[model samples]
Target: MGEAKELSQEEIEKIKEEIERLKKEIQYHDWRYYVLADPVISDAEYDKLVLRLRELEEKYPFLRTPDSPTQRVGGKIEGGFPTFPHSIPMLSLDNAFSEEELVEFEKRLKRFLGDENLEIEYSVEPKVDGVSIELIYEGGVLKRALTRGDGYVGEDVTPNVRTIKSIPLRLLGDDIPFLLEIRGEIFMRREDFEILNRELLKAGQKPFANPRNAAAGSLKQIDPSETAKRKLDAVFYASGLIKGVEIKNQKELLQKIFSWGFKVVPDWKIVKGIQEVIEHARYIYGRRKDYPFESDGVVVKVNDFRLREILGEKAKSPRWAIAYKFPAEEVTTRVLWVEFQVGRTGTVTPVAILEPVRISGVLVSRATLHNFDEIRRKDIRIGDWVWVKRSGDVIPEIVKSIPERREGFEIEIEEPRNCPSCGSELYKPQDEVALRCPNMSCPAQIIERIKHFVSRNAFDIEGLGEAIITQLVTKGIVKDISDIFFLRKIDLLKFWGIGDKLASKIIDNISKSKEIPLDKFIFALGIRHVGESVAKILAKRFRTLDEFLTANPKEIETIYGLGPAVAQSVEKFLRDEKNIASIKRMLQAGVKVLDYHEESEQRKKGALSGKTFVFTGTLKSMTREEAKKLVIENGGKVLDTITSHVNFLVVGDLGDRGTTSKLEKAKKLGIKLITEEEFLSMIKGS
Candidate 1:
């Protein structure tokens, strides 16, 4: 390697040719090592070729381009993520459920092309259930990794993406484009996901719902180091932004990416017609468990790129590609009866007691009706044969009821007007649809509240499961949350299931729960609209229980992120004589809520302080209370009413009336309108 200097024409040409040859050789080895997982050359041999290329690029600075293999040395740290516009709009695929639908899709493609006699080859592959990403390469090096944010614009997650070993740092081929954006799915392997979830559980963290959830959560982590630990894998499926070359068909595109050392989806095949496509889809669906990753269905596409162009695309999806989603794992059962159950927050939800049926390898004797409104909407009735499906093969839910098979004995359900457990009058809150048991002392509500109080994220009292809570409430050993602390070993030993060992364990857990943080104590109280995040904000704002109880509604309202409804709820709860008495009893029973006074003083210097925020509508990623807590945690303020002092008006799925008033007010005040995604990004960075 030599420094850049004026060189003879012959030397320059020779060096350029060598650089190209080295790039080609490195790319071939990369393909063999990465995509094929069969390295033709030894690791030392591969390193030599990369070293030579780097030397040539270093000596001839002008020869160094974005696509140069030398540029793949990716370790750049980003401060804040910026939005990157996709070179080509990343369109989603339409779905087909059955073989008949698949045939119809072929017909639609033929109809659009206006060539009935045309034979269209189909390329079918398993549709990976993971986070969609667009990885951009320049010259030969990886440049940017982006999320499929709304198709057009996406957040740059280059730093996190760089940590994935499966994703190549640079394109291997000598013909690497000036700019290429390869679209792929980033996922966690099933085994790795299980390991991660097990570790999370052991560490007292909530485990991920599924592999897809774990992958998405890992990818979106603000800390790249955390993502790096997840061992994510990716497979390229399509091209988003391409330059300097053209691909002829889906098969060709897949092969080209594979050749460039990009891992393409496995088990893909090019078939002659719709029948073959259907057969391939069936095979993949049946053998889905054999794969290392999770896939919901298989994707079928018109093989020829020319035909795809002629068929074109719809507003939301491509006409050429259709995802054949597997039928939901479902079973048929009869609803014995519908029971209304009260939650810790007093919301009464309807649960259906079903004739025992096996669904997705699990016995589902009970399913949630969600609420009375859903029961009515679905027209569910007692003794009716209903279709039940386990969502994500986890929670069993009634999908629909069969009217034709309904017997005359089937009964139409009447919504409960009173709490079933305590016969208390139930009331529907304003702007809410669900009927609630407002009485805090209701037996059902008391059981649920006590269960919630001891559950994880609150006091986290282990050994106090729903069964234990039921036993405690039924025997009158625990009439309220505070009663748990007062339970004696003799009293517990009297219960049918309680042995000496189990009783000691339960008593120990209850004793340990007494020394909880103020935030956890506040959350354990089960205040309406005050979730874990809101509890944290309240704990940070008020140093002691006395301060929190003494704070007026107006004073609470002034704190940033406290919405009008939440402020009112807090005030009303505090003013309740029974609620106050429960707190006093808990305190007297040796409950010690640790004050975070020092922590609150430290939080005053947080990045968000002094800035007022007003949020309108429902946030999808988090609750309004959670969003407000983030703002408060960062030292920002939350306002119930949008005013001129408000710096930002965070908007989500706004109601018509709420949107109109807030939008007009914000416009008048010249406040910035922030989308929920933007606000979330801001919080992550903060």
Candidate 2:
């Protein structure tokens, strides 16, 4: 390769000017926040400075890139993946359950290294609940993306990986070195997760169980388009291969990754030894879920990479790393009483009210008691000091009461005789934990139903929380669900803190919600056993609200997933006089009953419609999955290698050479290019 041409003196001067400005701006803020612990600027203000540099990059388009602070959100998620062979295997880390186990790991480390002089310096970080992935960069260009499959061999998911905007397309800015293998955890944001699950419900799909599962399930989508729609991100934690870099320690590597525009974990402090590490561990445990993402535990790794290399591998995992889980933050609190809440599934859940106590950096005044079985098994009683725990930022659960500690004060446990909400007799269903509230018209049920109607999954009415809902009912600003649609902002403003701007936003959201899809409308009705998925299935099957309402229960039950019980619920819900009147009120108020059946039907059809593909080399124009979807929709197949039966081979060079063999064979056998333009065309072809 010939020497690349240098810019003119004027160009160089301008680049120098921009670089100086960026450096001063970054360091000034770093000191103010990191050192001083007093940030004058908000996150959005900091983002503005970075965004300016990015905008400059777009303008100049070819400045000598520096490994400056701003490149972390990655370029554009590249189109296709290229092959990358690991120079060093990115291995897993070992776990330490007890203090004794940690001491054993330390002792084992000394034995492995056979060096008594080793005073191990470690880097501790929160172990986020997410999927692990690898990003490969060669000579500043993003080469490939990989999953930590089996440690040695992994699934080639370049296409799917390309959707993550955080993984750079070509290395952003000055770039780090010739070869860099960045390992990271991919996770979804909490707000994004809530949004996605809401959408999932409206689309008639099962909601993801949790954030970690959501991230895992999202990254594995064969359709890049599907994955792309999900807002997912990656956080770089460790390195696999470093070329031309002399960062001697793990802490430096983390800072370097941050400087190079990788979203490394937050800063860590070094301790003299394990004792300090233990204190730091406790401090982190105290504040674990306070962070944006969920963390199962904290990972303690040997700081020095050279020292780590000396310690080497033990079995499958690196000997240098040990994870310390937060001690379960269980609390002893009093459960004033147990109450049952009926969910969309008709499963009534019992919740416990408690004397407020701070646990795990959160106020714990309530806990889920589970049910009669849990209460009996734990021997929980009123006025008892019951143990409560909140893990990974979720709802708190009661573990047990101190039976032996009971003075004559703790009263006998008694399950409520009747539905607290409806005043009907409460009965425990066969093989069930919850006590049921069969009367749907109960005041509590109506209140909960109203809240659900305005929930993010249903109408998505903003500025309407449970507190506001209660106030609305009391003030008579709203009654039936349809009342929300009929009301005006002037009506809402009568509430105590309701301001002009917020009131406008709420009323606007209400107006906007009138255009909601059919599934949301159905969910807003609060029919028993009718969640987002069932609503969508019904919406698509019936194609119209009128068609669905009039359809016989037998026809409703014909849908594969809809059984007799669900069908009966649907019919019963539609037959209710209140429900019938509510629908009329909604339609009269101009609420849209949309037809999303065509789209939902398309999704149900397997979406691969069943086509397969295999790709090689880097795809510069688009991601592997994006291109794959095109081939799949065109009724073509993609294979991993250039076998005789291979229908097509996407032959493109990223920065790898190993894929040449497959391409050469494809040329001889005339396998096709999952062409960029044609691939895009094919995706929409269906």
Candidate 3:
């Protein structure tokens, strides 16, 4: 190779200037293609600019900078994502399913402000159904990106986020804020999601359930290059924490973000009053199907930042904002057949196989009939046209049967008398609509139980997916859930698709799952009526697996939140000799269930200690599970029922509906009723 000549100081400075210019040019082209959807140059031309930038940077490594467009997709992240606290919490919005609820939302805002007839301007934007994320910028340069883990904290996914071309590597304008936290959603367009799923299926990988899921999974990829291949997009809609900028209203804020080279939601409007807000919501809903991305609803917020501040926030959501949810999309499809599937709990669910139809951009081929009773109630028949409805991310369901369109050849779908998989006779429990297979050792039930046992919230064995579990069960290598722990790498390697490396990884994951918390172990058992919350309650009350195993139905029933049904189910499962034997075998196989209350002494004396809470209505800021988790984390208890011992009733938005039975009973019992905001305040203070 020829010796390279060293450049002079002036030449080096010129090269530095050229590198900066190329970065800016590439950024502009990226913005045009991704954000504006209007590229001035061709793809080859854009590639040439990027190529020249890469060559120059490669020749002179000193000229490279972190914010350079070429540095978008960096190396893989090690370990896992680190958690970071949001400067300001990203609260969820309360939902309004109807126009009346939307009007009521404005009424509530007025009521909170003590101004019944006040004229309030509202900003309406499409509520994109995607993963929420926060992008931090310091000194007008992209610093980090975080996923919305909870309202107060998030997971750092900066590497994956940087791969998104739509997001600017650095702020474009000179008037950028010194520090800005832009809040937005990371989403995949319907076309991109379909393409990605197709590619995944081609590669023998599982396809994503929805666009939102695709976006979320892509954002969490360990490698940024993998995330880049997913073609993810983002749109900035709000600001979290900002300095050195004066934004007076939502409209101005969005404009400012756009000027900084961030994509904002294309359709948004500022309306004068609640009526105009309702109109705008209706307009958005009407055009929802025409949008490129998935949007479940329209978010209505107080236009003025001052008004929003004055209105303040509740525990999990803002008081000044509400989401007007569009109605579930309904489509007509013929039921080709009805198939019965057995679940972990042995409940036989009737699934209607329908002629393939597309709803909300997803190809739907099957819809749940819920149960045999529902099938009879709805008079659903095979070979009959039915009205199927699909909401955002929810499973498609048969809304009703169209008897008028049904010909005389249509056959009435009847409940199966025998289990489809094991051919065991099915029986119905008292007051229950579902038919249960009494046989515990049924192959279908065993497969489902093992699947549940290895699920994410249970044992969380990473490689034991459905396909692998099925092969294990069908081959008789795994007869029960306990057999999983005893699995040998040599045995796993004998499987068709299993190689040495995969077998080792699976064995490692299985071994790692042997020691789990008491709550997870209880939930993993696939108990009929016991869920994660119930398991936690049981684990906390019993402290250890041995104590829980010995507890009787009466003792379980006496535990605060658990009712007779749950108690009876637990007692029935534990009292069974076969189940006890399985438990013993699992223990012998080296499973160790940890103690429930393993917190420090200081944590045991948390602020809400000894206090019991019952929640009613829909909470806007967080899900019911999240609220319960918070309560447990803060040394409080959450009960499903309203009882005399309940200390407080945390009431959320009741919408247009009247008071619930729990709310009414809480009122009758004189239980202190606190708002969601108050409940959040208690936890924050703790």
Candidate 4:
């Protein structure tokens, strides 16, 4: 090859201009896709742009910059993440769990300011459930990312943060600050977290208990590439240290951050007085699930930056802001018995059978101990009263045992030496905390697998409850999950109490379930670590069962949001002769795995999107529950309390409850009050 010719000054300057153009174009696309959740171009189009930019930067190495979009996943730090002192202390916020406490917080502010009847404007935002970090930007470029380690000092996580596409590598606009310290929360979306846990399980590794844990774990990863795979996101909420620009208030600061190509807290509002703050808190608490990420509470801060200056700081937290926490979804329940249950993977888990208690409307009777180690760590004992917390859709867990409430009757839980289902010797894996039976033929394992295959999120085969599954496994009629497809009505008739009608209905349901979605089919296979969410991702990527089966570990690993563990598990399952045979048998029995299609954008954006509604009093047309369901179905949210954010307040028949507090509050806030008929009409029209 001929020697490469050196470019002239004009050529270099043109190249520089081209590079800047590409960087700006890529940054705009990134902002649109990541920050706005609205992309102007397709993934392939975006990739080409990035590829072109990379090629140009590669040929012109002298023009390469740290703020380039291609520099997202940097080389891993050799030693470990370094620690750095923050420009200003990243103080924690005091918490208030009730309206009264919030009022008290406001009263304290008033008392300190010596203004008795002082009207204060407060900025309210969701307290995002994630790890807190401070980002230092020097001359519009990101300088450092640090975790909130002790307020004054934090561990540098700049490399890991760069991997987050939502977080900008450099500030946009010409009026950028010379030095700016932005504080924000790094969180994983619920959907991403579900997919991640599925991959972790597939790799035979322990899954994160929640999204918050997953975000924290992903942020601290040594490898930037690993962090990039996590699809972590962030939202900048507050500014710590700013040198060039001056912000008047919290709302203005948030807007400034948004203008600088960063996502601020969603649906943040400015309200007058403490009551409005309490109302916002109630609204947030009621519709927390509507958000993509977990939010534990609402952060209420004095809107005026000058007022914040007057309030100053406390020892560990800011006096201007207080976190209005949602009510704990926890209930004290006595553990009746500690039952050892064997999973489909033959892993023995300790489950605490609790005295029946209601938590967030669900009647909880049992909570997972996770493993023997968790039981020991929590010191959970049979007959001991424990605090069972049920957050969102996550399974209720024993937060901690109430040692003070425990009586002499409480018995310390002992690790079982034998599998609960099969009398096999139980052994704990060297690297895992779980004890396994190592028996694939264990009856409990078989029953559990069959149950999982027919679960609501899987094949959804109706009339096949746990009792029937247990009976099928015990009688040796159904040896495996695939056997259920070939079950004859005669075989079901042989079992006692199985009537002709029930058996026929079950067989009909099983037949109807043959034509299932690919994602459901994948989940029904009872593959370890492949949950419904992961199955959907796999289905979308592979499109067909044949494609998935033909895929090797390398091909599978190349897919975004998937790691080696998930790829290996999928490849291993497909390679297994028995599994393949079972799959073939199922196919031969007329199981058709249909291709997956994503929900249309129009359908995803419901008619009542971004609208908040509150229902009060009694309705003659429908129950409150029915009304709330309609709102949710139409992509609207329902809150228990009336706030400024509420678009409509649904009013029912007053009866003896005329001019209720909710109505008065709604009137005070100027929220639209709609009659029951109007509400019905609105939903019907939508």
lDDT of 4 by residue, 1-686 (tens): 01114677787798799989999999999999999999999999999999999998888777899999999999976555679998788876766756887887888789889998999999999989789999999999998999998678999999999999999998988889999899999999988988998999999887876688899999988789999999999998998889999899998899999999999998799999998888888788878888878887899999999999998975346889988767768889899998988998788888999999866544688898887767887788999998898754456888888899966988989888988888999998664678989777799999999999988768888778888888899999988788989998998888866778778878988998899998889888877656554576688788988887887789767655455656776887888887888899999999998988864565346666657777887654345655665565666666555546678988875532265667887898899999865775565452
Instruction: Name model 1 segments beyond 4 Å from true.
Output: 1-33, 39-80, 331-347, 351-367, 371-396, 399-424, 427-686
Q: Give the count of colliding residue pairs in each prediction.
A: 15, 17, 1, 1
The C-alpha lDDT values of all candidates are 0.79, 0.68, 0.86, 0.82
- Writing each residue's lDDT as its tens digit, candidate 3 over 1-686 gives 11124777788899899999999999988888988999999999999999999999888887799999999999988756789999999877767777887877787788878898899998899998889999999998999898888678899999999999999989987888999999999999889999998999999998987798899999988788999999999987998888998889999999999999999987899999989988888899888888778887899999999999898875557878888878767899999998998998899999999999977766799998878767877888999999888765556888888999977999988778999989999999885678999999888999999999999889999888888898889889999888998899988887888877678888988888899999999999988867776788899899999899998789888887667767878988988898888889999989988989765565567667878888887675567777887787777777776667789999986533356668888899999999886887687572
Top candidate when judged by TM-score against the true structure:
3
TM-score of 3: 0.84
Which wins on TM-score, candidate 1 or candidate 2? Answer: 1
Candidate 4 TM-score over all chains jointly: 0.53
Model 2 over residues 1-686: C-alpha lDDT tens digits?
01113666776677768965874576456445533447799989988887887766656555535334443223333322334445567665655545665666677667667875668787878787788888877886666778776477555566666666555555544646888888888888777888998999998887875677898888766467777788787777888878977788877887777766557765466665676677777777777667656676788888888878776664345667877656557778777876667654345677888998866434577787666776787788887877787654456888668877777777766777777655777777664457777766555666777888988778888678887787877666676888888878888788877778768878888898887787678767877656555666577688877887787888877764455656777888877888889889998999888866455344435333444445776443344544554453344444334444455455554231243556676678776657432433344442
- Candidate closest to the true structure, highest lDDT: 3
TM-score for candidate 1, please give it.
0.52
| Candidate 2, backbone clash total | 17
Model 1 residue 69 lDDT?
49
Q: What local lDDT does model 3 show for residue 211?
A: 90
